[model samples]
Target: MPDLALDIAFAWATLLLFGGGLLLLRARDAMHRILALDVLVSIVVAQLTILSYSRDVSYYIDAALALALLSFTATLVVARYVTRGRPF
Candidate 1:
């Protein structure tokens, strides 16, 4: 029963990730695309956290953290570029 629940949760997460990816690709405006990308990154982090919980692995958490940091930095760079025309 527990395993079945986990499977269902994972399935939902996968669907959300797919949807977010599609949204990111379909966005017409730069701001909308940035928001969609953030959503996609968030979904990836959630999936990683769920995997870590189900598999009893710590490395997944570490990987998720690293991904989050990268996402944050990228977002900042992009925001800067969008506002000021330069990322660095």
Candidate 2:
């Protein structure tokens, strides 16, 4: 059923978020940790978007946009820190 598939998707997304968190903890290098952190954030955003669709809530969409902006800034800052140079 379509509902079952949606539920499965949600479960899978949660697993992905958990796995990313573990990766972030286990990752040794700064770059790898940053990538894992980004993946975790992306998974959370995906979950929020899916919930928004299911509930027909416009507020979650706004939350997704805010997450995107903050994640982008975080990535940039982490990249600069990891590379020790400006990203151009």
Candidate 3:
């Protein structure tokens, strides 16, 4: 079973995820989409952390950390690609 408050937070995060996806799709500028993507990733990390707390499991935290790092790296690559036409 999950903690109620954390579960509510998770639900809110899911809602934000949907909202972020909509924002990303609605955004016309490349930079605006990138910003929306970052916000989405941050919200996902928060959700994962909440899941870990609610479940009393340590593995989700590890997954969340990995996700955060991956998101950071991916964002950097995408930003670079946007600016340079190549990820490298």
Candidate 4:
């Protein structure tokens, strides 16, 4: 029962993340897109955390942490590029 519950939860989360990502892709403003990207990344992290509960491994958490940091940096860089008109 618990296993089935987890599977359902994962499926729901995946659908939500994909939907949010598509919305982000359709956003007109770069900033809005970036924010949406952040939301998607967070959803991915949440999914990974849930996976950790069943996998008996903490590696996913570490990767999720790394992804959080990388996503933050990516958002900052894209914002800067959009604002400054250059990578710099």
Candidate 5:
């Protein structure tokens, strides 16, 4: 059923989240670290979406939206800073 599928997806997302964290920690360069962080945020967003569906809560989706927007803006700023030595 769909519930079982969602559970599987949630487990995968959790594993990915931990893997992303490891990648972020192991990255030796600024760009690599930035990319890892973005990946982590994306995984978190996916997990949040799964939670929203499974729990039937609207707020989780809203929070996920806000998080995604913030992550995107932050990634843009950080990427600029890493390449240009300044964020603006």
Candidate 6:
């Protein structure tokens, strides 16, 4: 029963990930693109976390953490570049 629930959740997450990618591609403005990219990253992290929980694997959790950090740094850099015309 619990496995079925996890599978359903995973399916929903996958759909959300796909939608986020589409939004990222279709965004008209730099800021909108950045927001969509952030959403995509967040969905990826959520999928990784769900995979870790379903498989009882510690490495997936670690990878998710690393991905989250990288996404945060990237978002900050992009936002700075968009606002100031340069990221330092």
| Candidate achieving the largest TM-score | 5
**Stronger candidate by TM-score (2 vs 6):** 6
Q: Tens digit of lDDT per residue, candidate 5, span 1-88?
A: 9999999999999999999999999999999998999999999999999999999999999999999999999999999998889998
Window of ten residues with lowest summed lDDT in model 2: 79-88
- lDDT score for candidate 5 against the true structure: 0.95
lDDT of all predictions, in order shown? Answer: 0.90, 0.88, 0.90, 0.90, 0.95, 0.93
If scored against the real structure, what TM-score would every candidate get? 0.89, 0.89, 0.85, 0.81, 0.97, 0.95
lDDT of 1 by residue, 1-88 (tens): 8778878888998999899889988999888898899888988898898899899999999999999999999999998899899999
Q: Which of the predicted structures, 5 or 6, would earn the higher TM-score when compared with the native?
A: 5
TM-score of the candidate numbered 1? 0.89
Per-residue lDDT tens digits for candidate 2, residues 1-88, read 8678778889999999888988999999989988998898899889988888878898998999899899999899879977986555
Q: Over 4 Å off in model 2, which ranges? A: 85-88
Clashing pairs in 4: none
Segments in model 5 whose C-alpha atoms lie over 4 Å from true places = none
The candidate maximizing lDDT is 5
Model 2 quality (TM-score): 0.89
State each candidate's clash count: 0, 0, 0, 0, 0, 0
Writing each residue's lDDT as its tens digit, candidate 3 over 1-88 gives 4467777888899999999999999999787888899899899899889888877899999998999999899899989999999999
Candidate 4 minimal-lDDT segment of 10 residues: 48-57
